[model samples]
Target chain A: MPDAIDFWFSTGSTYTYLTVSRLEQVEAATGMRFNWRPFSVRAIMRVQNNSPFANKPVKMGYMWRDIERRAGLYGLPVKVPAPYPLQEFDRANRVALLGLEEGWGKPYIVASYRRWFVDGQEPGMEPNLSASLREVGQDPARVVGQAQSDRIGGVYGAATDEARRLGVFGSPTFAVKGELFWGDDRLDDAICWLKHGRLVA
Target chain B: MPDAIDFWFSTGSTYTYLTVSRLEQVEAATGMRFNWRPFSVRAIMRVQNNSPFANKPVKMGYMWRDIERRAGLYGLPVKVPAPYPLQEFDRANRVALLGLEEGWGKPYIVASYRRWFVDGQEPGMEPNLSASLREVGQDPARVVGQAQSDRIGGVYGAATDEARRLGVFGSPTFAVKGELFWGDDRLDDAICWLKHGRLVA
Candidate 1:
């Protein structure tokens, strides 16, 4: 087992927003540090041929409603700034990758989600993405230039491929030892499992 | 929404086993009474053309492992009495309907899960189903006879149809007012939502 939980997340995953926003609080509460991994869920879902909420209006509707309720419970807001299930997440995710190497990655991810879901700014688009990067004190031009580099692409693709190999069917997965716990709902369990050895007899 | 939470569940659903086993304990802890409605998730999933774990070995693997961990968390056991994703749940569900009408429904459901997941007994099988009915102090032959009647079939079908109409995409969902919360993970959120209106501004 790893010393830290590997939090596999996606740039466009609605629930990943919750995990990013709550990361600091959860760390403080549980005394556990997470290895924040930014990966391409769209590429993963493509391989699986599964789009859980795409073209499924009822499930999509439930997802939005569930997010709103969860955000409320977590003391957050959902402005729903831009259209969801957004397609162009590569830029945002790459920028997140760049931010990570420079120690601004976590806050950049949180700021991006706040822009997309809380602050009425479209994510992965011009101006909004740059503004989110700047909020965490990174020079947008410098960070984004590096983010769009071939080097960033290599690491980003590697993370997604690794996620697939781990049998991670969805975003916001927690992986430790040989066990994979998918979805934000299992976050607590993952933490406990990491600490208590599955709590089974 | 309704005065009490409508706990829509399927007898064969793996997660529903957790909900059924936890029902009384949850009610006692939260002081919330549940309106248990026995419905066919197989019928609902068929209408959606979805079998989330069918032919999806990875997800199915995660589910059983997750259930075992949860059973451990809740101090229960998964004896794996019979093959999972059992196909013949209609007989067991019909008996549940009959049990409910005679005020033994809740315990019957719990006993049935205990038999299926805890004890080494196959659900919907001859001796097991009869033994479950008798555990609730009901006449196995008489209850199963009435359960097999046209009226039970009618109500059973109606509940399944109602679940479909309610946009219930999965089993072990909690429906409150006009909102629907899916999965056992949302069970706590559903209760909190019922008690305190969403907890958001």
Candidate 2:
């Protein structure tokens, strides 16, 4: 079997920012391929009823500080978006699906993550999404128009279902074989698993 | 100021079991004091409406596997109790308060955690609670009786309120100064923060 890891995230996920920032380095170090998959985190949260950011004020305060602290440690710049979560991830994910298929997923996804997080821009907005597409050398008009089609919507829905099937409750989930490792911290463990099979005592 | 970290947990918390398992080594290494405080995690979860174990089936499955995986990595054995989350943590917390006050807090708390998670025993039961107290060199009847008093109940209530005021949302939260590091994964970070203060880079 080929050595591959599934990289699952949503455009709006905070922890995903941390994972995406250093993902290329991890890939290079492990000499492994990453299946960059984007899905709707809001849908998963809605089903789970666990949006601590919006519900728990105390956790929300700590999370912002934790993100900044972690980002600094990783040597990456992060600025929390103006309106957090930017619930309209459908438009951005639609284009992301196309990008993943077209071999520009890495750059397109990273740039869009920067747009939403580092630059504090809204990915759901046309100018923001189109700019990311343009940077990845894709025709902005063609990609944007194609993303709005029913076919892309169907593909996006299927991807969310796949995430649920794969037991992904949170973002930045890394999966090797059938074992799932959730959150940014587990990236190292997942990479280790990829490099050297299951952990044995 | 004394170099101390607030060790926060509920008797029924799974992740807290992981932290309590290795807490002594961390204390020995850092030469830091831990203020072991037990509170009702169920009450906090109710306020947040984020109980994935009970609400989200997928998450609950993943959590068990994750906990077991982490426990193995930490060189600690874990056995899931008959009924997870043991809703009645009042009995355990009451006696735990007395344990903390009497300075046998570390052994008392670790024994109680082993009873619940490793031995698959209930903490709220008289037989189980009494056994833990006796193992810690305390008179079972006296400690049990003292734990049932109105004063201890009041003290336990105040501790939960203090946890809320300190912005603690989850079990196994290690707090130093005003920074809150939540979850078992954060224990290392909290210890590092204690040993080296805050990260500036």
Winning model by DockQ: 2
Residue A128 alpha-carbon offset, candidate 1, angstroms: 2.3
- Which ranges in model 1 have alpha carbons more than 4 Å from their true place? A1-3, A80-82, A199-201, B1-3, B80-82, B119-121, B139-141, B199-201
Instruction: Candidate 2: list runs displaced more than 4 Å.
Output: A199-201, B199-201
For residues B1-201, what per-residue lDDT tens digits would candidate 1 score against the true structure?
344899998888888888889879988988888888888888777766667777667677778888887887778778642367775689878888878888999998898888888775666776678888888898887887888899999999999989888988888899987789999878888887788767432
Best candidate, lDDT-wise? Answer: 1
> What's the TM for model 1?
0.90
Worst 10 residues of 1 chain B by lDDT: B79-88
For candidate 1, what is the interface RMSD?
Answer: 4.2
| Kept native contacts, fraction for each prediction | 0.51, 0.44
Task: Residues A8-111, candidate 1: write the lDDT tens digits.
Answer: 98888888877888889999988888998889988877766667777567677778778777777788767542367765689878878778888998988888
